[model samples]
Target chain A: MTIYYSEDHEWISVDGNVGTVGITNYAQNALGDIVFVEVPEVGDDFAKGDEVAVVESVKAASEIYSPVGGKITETNGELEDNAALVNSSPDGDGWFFKINISDSGELEGLMDADGYKTFIAGLE
Target chain B: MGAVNNDLLKTPLYSLHEELDGKMVPFAGYLMPVQYPLGVMGEHNHTREKAGLFDVSHMGQVVIKGNNADKWLETLVPGNIIDLKPNRIRYSMFTSEDGGILDDLMITKRENDIFMVVNAACKEQDIAHMRSNLPDHLELAELNNRALVALQGPMAAEVLARFASGADEMDFMSYAEVEICGATCLISRSGYTGEDGHEISIPAQKAIEVCKALLSEQEVEAIGLGARDSLRLEAGLCLYGHDITEDTTPVESALIWSIGKRRREEGGFPGAQIILEQISNGTITRKRVGIIPSGRVPAREGTEILDSADNVIGVITSGGFGPTFGGPVAMGYVDIKNSENGTDVFLKVRKNKLEAKVSATPFVPQRYYRKQK
Candidate 1:
């Protein structure tokens, strides 16, 4: 599986046509403590840059944008009870949803691991 | 964010906040920390369970002296300043001519002078207002050489007693001069968090030393404005700008308790006619009340509140996730008819209307320490 990141700080791990999406570690760190996670429902279709989820922190609520065009296949139900997982493990068990890719070409616009590292460094 | 300009003010602990990896933000023309590495939720929970130290030096502190100080102050607010005993603090507000709140503040009556703490953003206006209305005999002096810090929580007194003697003997809303870490400071047994805590005023040059000393204790940790805001919100306290703006009146904001009994009977302060009339006639159109949304989605400021018929009844003034309540708790104004406890309401959150209820304030029960007679 190869992980790709978007400039908006969303990350997606791709395996075949299925891609699991979540926010990057940098995004969670900047968001502080995650109190609520509004995940996209299964079968919800979204294009790149579409607001698909909401993550509410103690200070403010922020929207999580979709990194690529796809239909949500499954959402991580554990987030409803344990939203802090996003802060503890942003890119692993904290995945927000899994999406079935509608078009492989949409993934081309996202950055690879090294490119994302440079992108985040530029933010500082 | 980085400092927008060189003109912004810096607190005495600015470097210490930076060293602790605090995310600095510009607030009320001062570069201050909004959150540190512990995060807002962590800081908030820590404050409820242990203790949190907040750098509130940005707030304006002023001392009023002279024989006519109490009489001069009565012209500004509706609180009973003349009857306030020495070393006791009273929560009050500066009122406008039209019965609106100019700014809320804490007034401490000392034996020789009156000490006042006002909001940072309104400090200039407050000073100008007081100066223009001052009787020549009364002198108002701003304490620019002092830094204020609030140590709050259930464990606050225990940690504070370690440094300042006689801290444990102070009841809620009491003030005294105490020695802490070799510095003589003015300490008040009061805080905005609705918890047993104290606000200490120290010399600006020695602020860092005092703060470092307190933070070295096991129960104390440095908190930021973000957690301070959440804690105050959970405590059902008003945020000066957001909750009690100049457009809102004290009676309408549900702060009628702050008005003294004598002031309510024979009123002479600004807007006394309107406030006194509202108190007796039951003519207040709206009232501020606590709001509890039924879901996890935090209803934030500006969220519209609706009645059962879908009519916009009011708007949220302060709303957020309460760390102790483990749910979304908010405070907002509603139509006076709909402001009763347990009244069902709806919050328009994005595309959905979430169910909410009007509840009694201090979403979590206040843990203030009251003296047992």
Candidate 2:
């Protein structure tokens, strides 16, 4: 599996033609407590940079954008009842959705592990 | 006058907040901690179960002293300030000439003077309003050297009692001067969290020392503004800017309970005519009511409220997730006819119309301490 990160703090772990999407640790930390999460529907088609989900904290609501164009194959239904999973495990069980990649070339635009670390460092 | 510079002001506990890993954010032109390492949810739950300390120095505290100070101040608000006994506090508001609220404040009658705490954003204008209308004999002194902190939650009184003797005996809405950590402090047995707690005002120089002492207790944790906002919202308290603004009248905001019967009958304060008529004739067009969204989605501020037929009935003023309530909670101004409790409403968030209900406030029950008769 290859992992890529977006500037908006979303992480996609690609395996074959499917990629699992979720927010990064830094993004979840910045968002604080996760009270509500509106995940995308299965079979929904989205283009790159489309607002796919929304994460509401106690203080504010933040949008989650799609990093690459794809059709959502599955969504983490557990998030409907336990949104705090995004805060506890942003990169693992907290995965928001699984999308079938429409074009493999879009991965070139995202950052790798080292590059994302450097990008977050610049933010601080 | 607008602040030309971009620099944000810091409270006396700025350094302490940073030391505690508080996420600093800009609020009311001041750098304040939005949340600490525990996060807003943790901090909120901790505050409800135990004690939480907060740095509220950004609020404006002032002293008004003179003969007939209470009567003089009563002219600005709709509360019965003249009847307020020494050390008793009354929640009041400054109303405009047209029956709109200018600012909400806490007025405490001390032995020789009246101590008032106003919202930080409205302090300058509130002070200016009081100064221009002063009777010459009355003096308003803004306290810049004081830092206010609130110790709130179920265990707050027990934690504070270790420092200030007899603090637990003070009745809710009572104020007193007490010595804690070698500093003379003004303590109020009241809080915004709907919990039994105290709001302490200490010298700015002694703020750090006093806060450190309060935090040293096992049950106490340093809470931030984020949790404070949620806590107050859960408690059904109104935020000055969002819930009650200069354009919102006290009658429309469901704060008529704070007005005394004498003030309602005599009609002496600003906007008294309009306000009194609204009280007698039930002429308010909009009413503030608690909204509970049925779904997990939160209907944030500015979200539109719709009736069953999709007609826009009102707008949400304050909306967020209430950790204590374990669900989405909100307060908004709805058409008076649709403001009944259990009336079904709809919240327009993004493209979705979530189901919501108009309900009574304080999603969580308030636990105020009242002295046994």
Candidate 3:
């Protein structure tokens, strides 16, 4: 699986045609404590950069944009009762949804893991 | 997005905050920490359960002295400053000439002078307002060389008593000068958080030492502005610019109790005519009320309030998830007719209409340290 990141701090891990999407660890840390997560419904369609989800922290609410155009196949239901999972394991169990990639070419526009690290460093 | 601008002022505790990995943000022209590694929720819960140390040096501290100081102050605010006994603190606000709130502040009657703590954002303007209004005989001395810190929670008294003698014996709203960690500090048994706490005003040079000594106590952990905001909201307190502004009147803001009975009867302070008229006639158009949203969706500031008929009635001033209350709570102004307790209201959050009710506050019971007789 190859991980791609957006400048907006969202991350997606791709395997075959399906991609698992979640906020990056850096993003979760910046957001502080997660209080609520609003996930998109299964079978919802989205284009790249469309606001597909919301993550509310103790401070403020942030929108999560779709990294690539796709149809949502599944959502992490555990976040309904346990939003802290996003802060605890943002890259793993805290995944927001699974999307069926509409176009593989869209992933090329995103930064790779190393490139994302350098980008985040520049932010500091 | 890059490092905080160097031009922003830093409090004496700036190095300590960086050492603790505090998330620095620019607020009110100061580079201050909004949260720590534990995050806002964790820091908030820690303060509720144990004790939280807050760096509140950004707030303005001033001393008003000279003969007839209290009498002169009484003309500016609606509260009874002249009758306030020595060493006692009273919550009051500076009222505009037209019956609007200029700024809310805490005034303490010290031995020979009055000490005031004003909001950080309004300090400069407040000083100018007071200076321009007061006679030359009355002196206003801004204490720029002091730093304020708050130790708050159920364990606050116990933790504070370790260093400052006589702290455990102080009652709510009372203050005393004491030696803490070898620095002479003015400690007050009052805080914005509803929890039992003490706000210590220490010398700017000794602020870091005093804070370090307090943090050494196991019960005390450094909290940030994030938890401070949530804690005050849960306590149903008014934030300066949001909950109470120049556009809001004290009567409409539900702060009528802060006005002294004598001040309420005789007209002396600014806006006395209008405030007293509203008091006797009960003709306040809008009134502040607490609200509890029905679901986990937190209603934020600027959310519109609607009545049963779906007509707009009010707008939320402050709203968020209360860590201590374990739910979403808010406070806002509604039409006087719909401001009664238990009045059903709807909040327009985004595109959906959420169910809510006007409820009484402080959502959690206030735990002030009143000396038991």
Q: What overall lDDT, based on C-alpha atoms, would model 3 receive against the true structure? A: 0.93
* Highest-scoring model, lDDT: 2
Off by over 4 Å in 3: B1-4
Score candidate 2 by lDDT: 0.94
Q: What is candidate 2's lDDT per residue for B1-373, written digit by digit as tens?
A: 1353258889999899989999888888888899999989999999999999999999999999999999989889999999999999999999999999989999999999999999999999999999987698998999999999999999999899999989999999999899999999999999899899999999999999999999999999999999999999999999998999888889999999999999888878889999898899999999999999998899999999999999999999999999999899999999999999999999999989999999999999999999997
Lowest-lDDT window of 10 residues in candidate 1 chain B?
B1-10
Clash list (residue pairs), candidate 1: none
**Lowest summed-lDDT stretch of 10 residues in model 2 chain B?**
B1-10
The residue ranges of model 2 lying beyond 4 angstroms of the native Cα positions read: B1-6
Looking at model 3 chain B, which ten-residue stretch has the lowest summed lDDT?
Answer: B1-10
Please say which candidate is ahead in DockQ: 2 or 3: 2
**Candidate 1 residues B1-373, lDDT tens each?**
4436477899888888988888888899888889888889889999999999999999999999998698789999999999999999999999998899999999999999999999999999999999999887888899999999999999999889988867977999999998877788999999998789999999988899999999999999899999999899989999999999888889999999999999999889899899889999988999999999998989999999999899999999999999989999999999998999999999999877999999998898889999997
Assess candidate 2 and give its TM-score to the true structure: 0.98
What Cα-based lDDT does every candidate model obtain?
0.93, 0.94, 0.93
| lDDT value, residue A21 of candidate 1 | 95
Docking class of 1: high
